[model samples]
Target: MSYPNPNPYGPPPGQQPGYGYPQQQPPSPYGAYPGGGMMPGAPAPYPTVMPGGVKAARVMLFVLAGLNLIGLIFAVMGLGSVSKASKNASEYTTSDAMTAMNVGKGLLIAVIVVIVLFIGAAIMLGAQFGNGGSGVRVGTIIFGVANTLVSLLSFPFGLVHTVLGILIIVFVSKDDGTAWFNRPRY
Candidate 1:
Protein backbone atom coordinates (compact mmCIF):
# COMPACT_ATOMS: atom_id res chain seq x y z
CA MET A 1 0.00 0.00 0.00
CA SER A 2 1.17 3.58 -0.72
CA TYR A 3 2.25 5.68 2.30
CA PRO A 4 0.15 8.79 3.04
CA ASN A 5 1.51 11.95 1.33
CA PRO A 6 3.49 14.18 3.70
CA ASN A 7 2.14 17.41 2.18
CA PRO A 8 -1.62 17.13 1.88
CA TYR A 9 -1.94 20.62 0.30
CA GLY A 10 0.40 19.68 -2.57
CA PRO A 11 -0.50 17.71 -5.73
CA PRO A 12 -0.94 13.94 -5.61
CA PRO A 13 2.04 11.67 -6.07
CA GLY A 14 3.33 11.37 -9.60
CA GLN A 15 1.44 14.46 -10.70
CA GLN A 16 2.64 18.04 -11.45
CA PRO A 17 2.21 20.75 -8.80
CA GLY A 18 -0.98 22.10 -10.43
CA TYR A 19 -2.17 18.92 -12.07
CA GLY A 20 -5.38 18.15 -10.16
CA TYR A 21 -5.95 21.63 -8.76
CA PRO A 22 -6.17 25.30 -9.73
CA GLN A 23 -2.78 26.78 -10.62
CA GLN A 24 -1.24 29.46 -8.47
CA GLN A 25 -0.17 32.71 -10.06
CA PRO A 26 3.51 33.53 -10.14
CA PRO A 27 4.86 36.35 -7.99
CA SER A 28 5.01 39.79 -9.55
CA PRO A 29 8.20 40.62 -11.37
CA TYR A 30 7.90 44.21 -10.14
CA GLY A 31 8.03 43.13 -6.48
CA ALA A 32 5.34 43.32 -3.76
CA TYR A 33 4.75 47.04 -3.42
CA PRO A 34 1.47 48.74 -4.28
CA GLY A 35 1.12 49.37 -8.04
CA GLY A 36 3.83 46.82 -8.69
CA GLY A 37 1.46 44.61 -10.62
CA MET A 38 -2.17 44.25 -11.47
CA MET A 39 -4.38 41.69 -9.74
CA PRO A 40 -6.34 39.17 -11.81
CA GLY A 41 -9.37 41.44 -12.31
CA ALA A 42 -7.89 44.77 -11.24
CA PRO A 43 -6.99 47.71 -13.42
CA ALA A 44 -3.36 48.25 -14.36
CA PRO A 45 -1.33 50.74 -12.38
CA TYR A 46 -0.42 54.12 -13.84
CA PRO A 47 3.12 54.68 -15.00
CA THR A 48 5.57 56.19 -12.53
CA VAL A 49 7.03 58.62 -15.03
CA MET A 50 5.21 61.25 -17.06
CA PRO A 51 4.70 60.35 -20.71
CA GLY A 52 6.50 62.18 -23.50
CA GLY A 53 3.28 63.35 -25.10
CA VAL A 54 2.08 64.94 -21.87
CA LYS A 55 5.40 66.70 -21.45
CA ALA A 56 5.15 68.10 -24.93
CA ALA A 57 1.65 69.35 -24.23
CA ARG A 58 2.86 71.05 -21.07
CA VAL A 59 5.61 72.80 -23.00
CA MET A 60 3.15 73.99 -25.59
CA LEU A 61 0.98 75.50 -22.90
CA PHE A 62 3.90 77.53 -21.55
CA VAL A 63 4.82 78.69 -25.03
CA LEU A 64 1.28 79.87 -25.56
CA ALA A 65 1.41 81.77 -22.31
CA GLY A 66 4.61 83.49 -23.34
CA LEU A 67 3.17 84.47 -26.67
CA ASN A 68 0.07 85.89 -25.00
CA LEU A 69 2.28 87.95 -22.71
CA ILE A 70 3.88 89.53 -25.71
CA GLY A 71 0.53 90.19 -27.29
CA LEU A 72 -0.67 91.79 -24.07
CA ILE A 73 2.20 94.29 -24.13
CA PHE A 74 1.47 95.25 -27.69
CA ALA A 75 -2.22 95.58 -27.00
CA VAL A 76 -1.51 97.88 -24.07
CA MET A 77 0.73 100.01 -26.25
CA GLY A 78 -1.96 100.19 -28.88
CA LEU A 79 -4.47 101.25 -26.28
CA GLY A 80 -2.20 104.08 -25.21
CA SER A 81 -1.80 105.25 -28.81
CA VAL A 82 -5.56 105.22 -29.22
CA SER A 83 -5.93 107.28 -26.06
CA LYS A 84 -3.44 109.82 -27.36
CA ALA A 85 -5.27 109.97 -30.69
CA SER A 86 -8.56 110.49 -28.85
CA LYS A 87 -7.05 113.45 -27.00
CA ASN A 88 -5.84 114.99 -30.28
CA ALA A 89 -9.19 114.32 -31.96
CA SER A 90 -11.00 116.02 -29.08
CA GLU A 91 -9.20 119.32 -29.82
CA TYR A 92 -10.50 119.29 -33.42
CA THR A 93 -14.10 118.58 -32.20
CA THR A 94 -14.56 116.07 -35.04
CA SER A 95 -17.25 113.62 -33.89
CA ASP A 96 -16.19 111.11 -36.55
CA ALA A 97 -12.57 111.07 -35.34
CA MET A 98 -13.70 110.81 -31.72
CA THR A 99 -16.08 107.99 -32.57
CA ALA A 100 -13.32 106.10 -34.38
CA MET A 101 -10.97 106.62 -31.45
CA ASN A 102 -13.54 105.35 -28.99
CA VAL A 103 -14.13 102.24 -31.06
CA GLY A 104 -10.41 101.60 -31.35
CA LYS A 105 -9.93 102.03 -27.62
CA GLY A 106 -12.77 99.62 -26.85
CA LEU A 107 -11.43 96.99 -29.20
CA LEU A 108 -7.92 97.31 -27.81
CA ILE A 109 -9.16 97.00 -24.24
CA ALA A 110 -11.08 93.89 -25.19
CA VAL A 111 -7.99 92.40 -26.82
CA ILE A 112 -5.90 93.17 -23.76
CA VAL A 113 -8.43 91.51 -21.48
CA VAL A 114 -8.62 88.42 -23.65
CA ILE A 115 -4.83 88.13 -23.86
CA VAL A 116 -4.45 88.45 -20.08
CA LEU A 117 -7.03 85.78 -19.44
CA PHE A 118 -5.47 83.42 -21.95
CA ILE A 119 -2.04 83.96 -20.49
CA GLY A 120 -3.27 83.29 -16.98
CA ALA A 121 -5.05 80.11 -18.04
CA ALA A 122 -2.12 78.78 -20.04
CA ILE A 123 0.32 79.34 -17.19
CA MET A 124 -2.01 77.84 -14.60
CA LEU A 125 -2.73 74.77 -16.69
CA GLY A 126 0.91 74.29 -17.63
CA ALA A 127 1.99 74.44 -14.00
CA GLN A 128 -0.58 71.78 -13.13
CA PHE A 129 0.83 69.25 -15.56
CA GLY A 130 2.93 67.45 -12.98
CA ASN A 131 0.11 66.58 -10.57
CA GLY A 132 -3.17 67.56 -12.20
CA GLY A 133 -5.98 65.10 -12.90
CA SER A 134 -8.40 64.56 -15.78
CA GLY A 135 -9.88 68.00 -15.14
CA VAL A 136 -6.55 69.49 -16.01
CA ARG A 137 -6.40 67.39 -19.14
CA VAL A 138 -9.84 68.57 -20.18
CA GLY A 139 -8.92 72.19 -19.40
CA THR A 140 -5.76 71.93 -21.47
CA ILE A 141 -7.68 70.43 -24.36
CA ILE A 142 -10.20 73.22 -24.25
CA PHE A 143 -7.43 75.81 -24.03
CA GLY A 144 -5.75 74.30 -27.10
CA VAL A 145 -8.95 74.29 -29.08
CA ALA A 146 -9.66 77.89 -28.18
CA ASN A 147 -6.13 78.91 -29.06
CA THR A 148 -6.41 77.15 -32.39
CA LEU A 149 -9.65 78.92 -33.26
CA VAL A 150 -8.27 82.29 -32.18
CA SER A 151 -5.09 81.70 -34.14
CA LEU A 152 -7.12 81.12 -37.26
CA LEU A 153 -8.27 84.73 -37.08
CA SER A 154 -4.65 86.02 -37.15
CA PHE A 155 -3.62 83.86 -40.14
CA PRO A 156 0.10 83.75 -41.05
CA PHE A 157 1.23 85.60 -37.95
CA GLY A 158 -0.56 83.02 -35.81
CA LEU A 159 0.96 80.07 -37.61
CA VAL A 160 3.09 79.29 -34.59
CA HIS A 161 0.10 79.32 -32.26
CA THR A 162 -1.85 77.17 -34.67
CA VAL A 163 0.88 74.55 -34.89
CA LEU A 164 1.48 74.55 -31.14
CA GLY A 165 -2.20 74.25 -30.39
CA ILE A 166 -2.62 71.31 -32.73
CA LEU A 167 0.37 69.58 -31.26
CA ILE A 168 -0.94 70.14 -27.75
CA ILE A 169 -4.29 68.69 -28.73
CA VAL A 170 -2.74 65.59 -30.30
CA PHE A 171 -0.24 64.95 -27.53
CA VAL A 172 -2.68 65.41 -24.69
CA SER A 173 -5.37 63.27 -26.28
CA LYS A 174 -3.20 60.18 -26.71
CA ASP A 175 -3.51 57.05 -24.56
CA ASP A 176 -0.37 57.90 -22.62
CA GLY A 177 -1.80 61.33 -21.84
CA THR A 178 -4.96 59.77 -20.49
CA ALA A 179 -2.88 57.51 -18.28
CA TRP A 180 -0.71 60.36 -17.00
CA PHE A 181 -3.65 62.49 -15.98
CA ASN A 182 -5.44 59.56 -14.41
CA ARG A 183 -2.45 58.30 -12.47
CA PRO A 184 -2.73 57.86 -8.71
CA ARG A 185 -1.44 60.82 -6.70
CA TYR A 186 -0.10 58.81 -3.78
Candidate 2:
Protein backbone atom coordinates (compact mmCIF):
# COMPACT_ATOMS: atom_id res chain seq x y z
CA MET A 1 0.00 0.00 0.00
CA SER A 2 1.18 3.57 -0.82
CA TYR A 3 1.47 6.02 2.07
CA PRO A 4 0.20 9.57 1.69
CA ASN A 5 2.58 12.57 1.98
CA PRO A 6 2.26 14.40 5.32
CA ASN A 7 4.48 17.46 4.88
CA PRO A 8 5.02 19.51 1.69
CA TYR A 9 8.44 21.00 2.53
CA GLY A 10 10.31 17.65 2.88
CA PRO A 11 10.57 14.86 0.23
CA PRO A 12 7.70 12.38 -0.17
CA PRO A 13 7.77 9.19 2.00
CA GLY A 14 10.01 6.37 0.66
CA GLN A 15 11.36 8.70 -2.07
CA GLN A 16 14.97 9.75 -2.73
CA PRO A 17 16.22 13.25 -1.79
CA GLY A 18 16.10 15.58 -4.81
CA TYR A 19 17.95 18.65 -3.55
CA GLY A 20 18.35 19.18 0.24
CA TYR A 21 19.10 15.86 1.97
CA PRO A 22 22.78 15.13 2.70
CA GLN A 23 24.44 12.08 1.16
CA GLN A 24 25.04 8.97 3.27
CA GLN A 25 28.59 7.87 4.04
CA PRO A 26 29.94 4.43 3.05
CA PRO A 27 31.09 1.95 5.70
CA SER A 28 34.83 2.11 6.39
CA PRO A 29 37.43 1.74 9.10
CA TYR A 30 38.35 5.40 8.87
CA GLY A 31 35.09 7.35 9.11
CA ALA A 32 34.53 8.35 5.45
CA TYR A 33 37.77 8.28 3.43
CA PRO A 34 40.43 5.57 3.65
CA GLY A 35 44.09 5.41 2.61
CA GLY A 36 45.12 8.41 4.71
CA GLY A 37 42.14 10.43 3.62
CA MET A 38 43.24 11.87 0.30
CA MET A 39 40.80 14.39 -1.14
CA PRO A 40 38.22 13.35 -3.74
CA GLY A 41 40.02 15.14 -6.58
CA ALA A 42 43.73 15.84 -6.26
CA PRO A 43 46.67 15.75 -8.64
CA ALA A 44 48.94 12.74 -8.75
CA PRO A 45 51.92 12.74 -6.43
CA TYR A 46 55.24 13.92 -7.89
CA PRO A 47 58.46 11.95 -7.88
CA THR A 48 60.26 12.59 -4.63
CA VAL A 49 62.84 9.84 -4.14
CA MET A 50 64.99 10.80 -7.14
CA PRO A 51 66.83 13.83 -5.73
CA GLY A 52 68.06 12.43 -2.43
CA GLY A 53 71.20 10.58 -3.50
CA VAL A 54 72.69 13.62 -5.22
CA LYS A 55 73.79 15.40 -2.04
CA ALA A 56 75.02 12.16 -0.52
CA ALA A 57 77.11 11.33 -3.57
CA ARG A 58 78.58 14.83 -3.62
CA VAL A 59 79.50 14.72 0.06
CA MET A 60 81.11 11.31 -0.34
CA LEU A 61 83.22 12.64 -3.18
CA PHE A 62 84.36 15.58 -1.09
CA VAL A 63 85.26 13.28 1.79
CA LEU A 64 87.32 11.05 -0.50
CA ALA A 65 89.14 14.09 -1.88
CA GLY A 66 90.12 15.09 1.64
CA LEU A 67 91.42 11.60 2.29
CA ASN A 68 93.55 11.78 -0.83
CA LEU A 69 95.08 15.05 0.40
CA ILE A 70 95.85 13.55 3.78
CA GLY A 71 97.51 10.60 2.09
CA LEU A 72 99.63 13.00 0.02
CA ILE A 73 100.79 14.80 3.17
CA PHE A 74 101.77 11.53 4.85
CA ALA A 75 103.54 10.31 1.72
CA VAL A 76 105.60 13.52 1.59
CA MET A 77 106.52 13.25 5.25
CA GLY A 78 107.62 9.64 4.92
CA LEU A 79 109.62 10.44 1.81
CA GLY A 80 111.44 13.20 3.68
CA SER A 81 112.20 10.95 6.61
CA VAL A 82 113.60 8.20 4.39
CA SER A 83 115.74 10.65 2.43
CA LYS A 84 117.19 12.12 5.63
CA ALA A 85 118.06 8.71 7.06
CA SER A 86 119.59 7.58 3.77
CA LYS A 87 121.69 10.76 3.60
CA ASN A 88 123.15 10.11 7.06
CA ALA A 89 123.99 6.48 6.21
CA SER A 90 125.55 7.38 2.88
CA GLU A 91 128.21 9.57 4.59
CA TYR A 92 129.88 6.45 5.98
CA THR A 93 130.14 4.59 2.62
CA THR A 94 132.34 6.24 -0.03
CA SER A 95 130.45 5.11 -3.21
CA ASP A 96 127.02 4.77 -1.59
CA ALA A 97 126.18 8.47 -1.74
CA MET A 98 125.20 8.55 -5.42
CA THR A 99 123.40 5.22 -5.21
CA ALA A 100 121.53 6.28 -2.08
CA MET A 101 120.52 9.59 -3.67
CA ASN A 102 119.27 7.77 -6.75
CA VAL A 103 117.18 5.38 -4.65
CA GLY A 104 115.70 8.23 -2.66
CA LYS A 105 114.81 10.10 -5.83
CA GLY A 106 113.19 7.01 -7.27
CA LEU A 107 111.16 6.45 -4.13
CA LEU A 108 110.05 10.06 -4.12
CA ILE A 109 109.07 9.82 -7.75
CA ALA A 110 107.03 6.68 -7.14
CA VAL A 111 105.21 8.25 -4.24
CA ILE A 112 104.51 11.33 -6.31
CA VAL A 113 103.10 9.25 -9.13
CA VAL A 114 100.77 7.32 -6.86
CA ILE A 115 99.64 10.52 -5.18
CA VAL A 116 98.95 12.21 -8.47
CA LEU A 117 96.93 9.29 -9.80
CA PHE A 118 94.74 8.97 -6.72
CA ILE A 119 94.36 12.68 -6.10
CA GLY A 120 93.43 13.23 -9.71
CA ALA A 121 90.80 10.52 -9.47
CA ALA A 122 89.36 12.01 -6.33
CA ILE A 123 89.11 15.43 -7.90
CA MET A 124 87.41 14.04 -10.95
CA LEU A 125 84.85 12.12 -8.91
CA GLY A 126 84.18 15.08 -6.63
CA ALA A 127 83.73 17.54 -9.46
CA GLN A 128 81.22 15.33 -11.28
CA PHE A 129 78.52 15.76 -8.64
CA GLY A 130 77.84 19.31 -9.79
CA ASN A 131 76.33 18.62 -13.20
CA GLY A 132 77.22 15.06 -13.92
CA GLY A 133 75.41 12.90 -16.45
CA SER A 134 74.68 9.16 -16.34
CA GLY A 135 78.30 8.53 -17.18
CA VAL A 136 79.20 9.99 -13.83
CA ARG A 137 77.25 7.25 -12.09
CA VAL A 138 79.15 4.56 -13.95
CA GLY A 139 82.41 6.36 -13.27
CA THR A 140 81.64 6.62 -9.59
CA ILE A 141 80.79 2.93 -9.41
CA ILE A 142 84.04 2.00 -11.10
CA PHE A 143 86.00 4.30 -8.83
CA GLY A 144 84.32 2.98 -5.71
CA VAL A 145 84.99 -0.65 -6.60
CA ALA A 146 88.57 0.04 -7.64
CA ASN A 147 89.16 2.18 -4.60
CA THR A 148 87.83 -0.52 -2.30
CA LEU A 149 90.20 -3.08 -3.81
CA VAL A 150 93.16 -0.70 -3.78
CA SER A 151 92.38 0.40 -0.26
CA LEU A 152 92.63 -3.19 0.88
CA LEU A 153 96.28 -3.22 -0.20
CA SER A 154 96.91 -0.29 2.15
CA PHE A 155 95.06 -2.13 4.96
CA PRO A 156 94.62 0.03 8.04
CA PHE A 157 95.45 3.25 6.27
CA GLY A 158 92.45 2.97 3.95
CA LEU A 159 89.92 1.21 6.14
CA VAL A 160 87.77 4.27 6.54
CA HIS A 161 88.03 5.14 2.90
CA THR A 162 87.10 1.62 1.85
CA VAL A 163 83.99 1.73 3.95
CA LEU A 164 83.01 5.12 2.57
CA GLY A 165 83.67 4.01 -0.98
CA ILE A 166 81.51 0.95 -0.56
CA LEU A 167 78.76 3.19 0.70
CA ILE A 168 79.14 5.36 -2.37
CA ILE A 169 78.86 2.39 -4.66
CA VAL A 170 75.81 1.10 -2.89
CA PHE A 171 74.13 4.49 -2.93
CA VAL A 172 74.76 5.08 -6.60
CA SER A 173 73.32 1.73 -7.59
CA LYS A 174 70.16 1.88 -5.51
CA ASP A 175 66.68 2.53 -6.96
CA ASP A 176 66.51 6.15 -5.89
CA GLY A 177 70.04 6.83 -7.00
CA THR A 178 69.41 5.25 -10.38
CA ALA A 179 66.26 7.30 -10.75
CA TRP A 180 68.18 10.46 -9.95
CA PHE A 181 70.74 9.73 -12.61
CA ASN A 182 68.11 8.85 -15.19
CA ARG A 183 65.93 11.89 -14.54
CA PRO A 184 65.30 14.32 -17.37
CA ARG A 185 66.73 17.75 -16.71
CA TYR A 186 65.63 20.73 -18.77
Candidate 3:
Protein backbone atom coordinates (compact mmCIF):
# COMPACT_ATOMS: atom_id res chain seq x y z
CA MET A 1 0.00 0.00 0.00
CA SER A 2 1.04 3.69 -0.61
CA TYR A 3 2.26 5.60 2.50
CA PRO A 4 2.67 9.46 3.24
CA ASN A 5 6.18 10.90 2.87
CA PRO A 6 8.06 10.74 6.18
CA ASN A 7 9.34 14.32 5.54
CA PRO A 8 7.84 16.96 3.22
CA TYR A 9 11.11 16.82 1.33
CA GLY A 10 13.57 13.94 1.09
CA PRO A 11 15.11 12.77 4.37
CA PRO A 12 18.26 10.81 5.18
CA PRO A 13 17.80 7.10 5.71
CA GLY A 14 18.76 7.11 9.45
CA GLN A 15 16.85 10.37 10.30
CA GLN A 16 13.82 9.73 12.70
CA PRO A 17 10.38 11.46 12.14
CA GLY A 18 11.05 15.00 13.57
CA TYR A 19 14.60 14.69 14.86
CA GLY A 20 16.90 17.81 14.92
CA TYR A 21 14.11 20.22 13.78
CA PRO A 22 14.11 23.64 15.64
CA GLN A 23 11.09 24.25 17.93
CA GLN A 24 8.64 26.98 16.75
CA GLN A 25 8.27 30.07 18.96
CA PRO A 26 5.52 32.76 19.17
CA PRO A 27 6.17 36.03 17.18
CA SER A 28 7.49 39.13 18.96
CA PRO A 29 8.24 42.49 17.25
CA TYR A 30 9.99 43.55 20.50
CA GLY A 31 13.46 42.20 21.23
CA ALA A 32 12.07 39.96 24.04
CA TYR A 33 12.64 36.22 23.66
CA PRO A 34 11.22 33.63 25.98
CA GLY A 35 14.22 31.90 27.61
CA GLY A 36 16.78 32.83 30.32
CA GLY A 37 18.27 35.64 28.11
CA MET A 38 15.81 38.09 29.73
CA MET A 39 14.06 37.72 33.14
CA PRO A 40 10.52 36.92 31.95
CA GLY A 41 8.37 37.30 35.09
CA ALA A 42 9.66 40.47 36.74
CA PRO A 43 7.08 42.96 38.19
CA ALA A 44 6.78 46.63 37.06
CA PRO A 45 8.08 49.44 39.24
CA TYR A 46 5.75 51.08 41.84
CA PRO A 47 5.92 54.29 43.92
CA THR A 48 7.04 53.65 47.51
CA VAL A 49 5.20 56.49 49.22
CA MET A 50 2.04 58.43 48.34
CA PRO A 51 1.94 62.25 48.11
CA GLY A 52 0.70 64.44 51.00
CA GLY A 53 -2.54 66.45 50.95
CA VAL A 54 -2.41 70.22 51.41
CA LYS A 55 -5.52 71.21 49.48
CA ALA A 56 -7.65 72.22 52.47
CA ALA A 57 -5.35 74.91 53.78
CA ARG A 58 -5.03 76.38 50.30
CA VAL A 59 -8.82 76.46 49.88
CA MET A 60 -9.27 78.21 53.21
CA LEU A 61 -6.67 80.79 52.26
CA PHE A 62 -8.41 81.47 48.94
CA VAL A 63 -11.76 81.77 50.70
CA LEU A 64 -10.28 84.29 53.12
CA ALA A 65 -8.83 86.25 50.24
CA GLY A 66 -12.19 86.26 48.45
CA LEU A 67 -13.91 87.50 51.60
CA ASN A 68 -11.40 90.35 51.73
CA LEU A 69 -12.15 91.16 48.08
CA ILE A 70 -15.92 91.08 48.57
CA GLY A 71 -15.54 93.43 51.50
CA LEU A 72 -13.71 95.95 49.31
CA ILE A 73 -16.43 95.78 46.69
CA PHE A 74 -19.10 96.53 49.29
CA ALA A 75 -17.15 99.50 50.61
CA VAL A 76 -16.72 100.83 47.08
CA MET A 77 -20.46 100.52 46.37
CA GLY A 78 -21.18 103.49 48.68
CA LEU A 79 -23.24 101.40 51.11
CA GLY A 80 -23.59 103.22 54.46
CA SER A 81 -25.15 99.93 55.64
CA VAL A 82 -21.83 98.50 56.69
CA SER A 83 -21.65 100.73 59.74
CA LYS A 84 -25.38 100.60 60.38
CA ALA A 85 -25.46 96.82 60.13
CA SER A 86 -22.42 96.58 62.36
CA LYS A 87 -24.16 98.61 65.08
CA ASN A 88 -27.39 96.61 65.06
CA ALA A 89 -28.03 94.73 68.34
CA SER A 90 -29.94 91.80 66.80
CA GLU A 91 -27.69 89.17 65.21
CA TYR A 92 -30.21 88.42 62.44
CA THR A 93 -30.53 92.05 61.35
CA THR A 94 -26.86 92.93 61.69
CA SER A 95 -24.20 92.04 59.14
CA ASP A 96 -21.84 89.21 60.09
CA ALA A 97 -18.87 90.63 62.00
CA MET A 98 -16.33 88.92 59.78
CA THR A 99 -18.00 90.24 56.65
CA ALA A 100 -18.05 93.76 58.02
CA MET A 101 -14.43 93.49 59.10
CA ASN A 102 -13.27 92.24 55.69
CA VAL A 103 -15.08 95.02 53.84
CA GLY A 104 -13.76 97.65 56.21
CA LYS A 105 -10.19 96.36 55.94
CA GLY A 106 -10.37 96.21 52.14
CA LEU A 107 -11.49 99.84 52.15
CA LEU A 108 -8.49 100.71 54.27
CA ILE A 109 -6.14 99.00 51.81
CA ALA A 110 -7.64 100.96 48.93
CA VAL A 111 -7.11 104.19 50.83
CA ILE A 112 -3.50 103.33 51.59
CA VAL A 113 -2.81 102.48 47.92
CA VAL A 114 -4.43 105.76 46.85
CA ILE A 115 -2.35 107.67 49.39
CA VAL A 116 0.82 106.09 48.05
CA LEU A 117 -0.19 107.05 44.52
CA PHE A 118 -0.88 110.58 45.75
CA ILE A 119 2.51 110.90 47.42
CA GLY A 120 4.33 109.62 44.36
CA ALA A 121 2.45 112.00 42.05
CA ALA A 122 3.01 114.88 44.46
CA ILE A 123 6.74 114.25 44.47
CA MET A 124 6.84 114.12 40.68
CA LEU A 125 4.81 117.31 40.35
CA GLY A 126 6.95 119.10 42.92
CA ALA A 127 10.08 118.14 41.02
CA GLN A 128 8.53 119.39 37.75
CA PHE A 129 7.51 122.64 39.43
CA GLY A 130 11.03 123.07 40.80
CA ASN A 131 12.37 122.56 37.26
CA GLY A 132 10.30 125.60 36.01
CA GLY A 133 7.34 123.67 34.48
CA SER A 134 4.68 126.32 35.28
CA GLY A 135 2.21 124.89 32.76
CA VAL A 136 1.46 121.76 34.93
CA ARG A 137 1.07 123.61 38.28
CA VAL A 138 -2.75 123.98 38.04
CA GLY A 139 -3.16 120.37 36.92
CA THR A 140 -0.97 119.13 39.79
CA ILE A 141 -2.97 121.11 42.33
CA ILE A 142 -6.21 119.68 40.98
CA PHE A 143 -4.83 116.12 41.21
CA GLY A 144 -3.66 116.63 44.78
CA VAL A 145 -7.03 117.92 45.91
CA ALA A 146 -8.92 115.12 44.15
CA ASN A 147 -6.66 112.48 45.64
CA THR A 148 -7.11 113.86 49.15
CA LEU A 149 -10.88 113.86 48.79
CA VAL A 150 -10.97 110.32 47.45
CA SER A 151 -8.68 109.02 50.22
CA LEU A 152 -10.79 110.74 52.86
CA LEU A 153 -13.97 109.18 51.48
CA SER A 154 -12.39 105.69 51.50
CA PHE A 155 -11.07 105.78 55.08
CA PRO A 156 -13.88 103.67 56.55
CA PHE A 157 -13.39 100.98 53.92
CA GLY A 158 -9.63 100.86 54.60
CA LEU A 159 -10.28 100.39 58.31
CA VAL A 160 -12.47 97.39 57.53
CA HIS A 161 -9.92 95.83 55.20
CA THR A 162 -7.19 96.20 57.81
CA VAL A 163 -9.26 94.36 60.42
CA LEU A 164 -10.06 91.50 58.01
CA GLY A 165 -6.45 91.14 56.86
CA ILE A 166 -5.38 90.92 60.48
CA LEU A 167 -8.00 88.25 61.18
CA ILE A 168 -6.94 86.15 58.17
CA ILE A 169 -3.27 86.31 59.15
CA VAL A 170 -4.12 85.32 62.69
CA PHE A 171 -6.25 82.31 61.71
CA VAL A 172 -3.86 81.07 59.04
CA SER A 173 -0.89 81.46 61.37
CA LYS A 174 -2.57 79.52 64.18
CA ASP A 175 -3.02 76.50 61.91
CA ASP A 176 0.58 75.22 61.91
CA GLY A 177 0.61 71.60 60.69
CA THR A 178 0.32 70.49 57.08
CA ALA A 179 -2.97 68.75 57.91
CA TRP A 180 -4.31 71.92 59.52
CA PHE A 181 -3.08 74.17 56.77
CA ASN A 182 -4.27 71.91 53.98
CA ARG A 183 -7.79 71.41 55.31
CA PRO A 184 -10.05 69.79 52.73
CA ARG A 185 -12.94 71.72 51.22
CA TYR A 186 -16.45 70.59 52.31
Instruction: Judging by TM-score against the true structure, name the best candidate.
Output: 1
Error of 3 at 45 (Å): 91
The TM-score measured for candidate 3 stands at 0.29
Which segments of candidate 2 are over 4 A away from where they belong?
A: 1-50, 94-108
Total clashes in model 1, counting residue pairs 3 or more apart in sequence or in different chains: 0
**Candidate 1: lDDT of 2?**
98
* Residue 63 CA displacement from its true place in model 2, Å: 0.8
Better of 1 and 3 by lDDT: 1
Per-residue accuracy of model 3 over 25-95 as CA lDDT, tens digit each: 66443436555243355432321221122223223334434543454465454445545545554755445
Residue 161, candidate 1: C-alpha displacement in angstroms: 0.9
Per-residue lDDT tens digits of candidate 1, residues 1-186? 999999998888878775776677666646566876654655456777888899889988998899889988999999999898777664657788788889999999988988999999999999999999999999999999999999999989999999999999999999989999998897
lDDT (Cα) of model 2: 0.74
Off by over 4 Å in 3: 1-95, 147-186
Candidate 1 pairs with clashing backbones: none
Q: Top lDDT: which candidate number?
A: 1
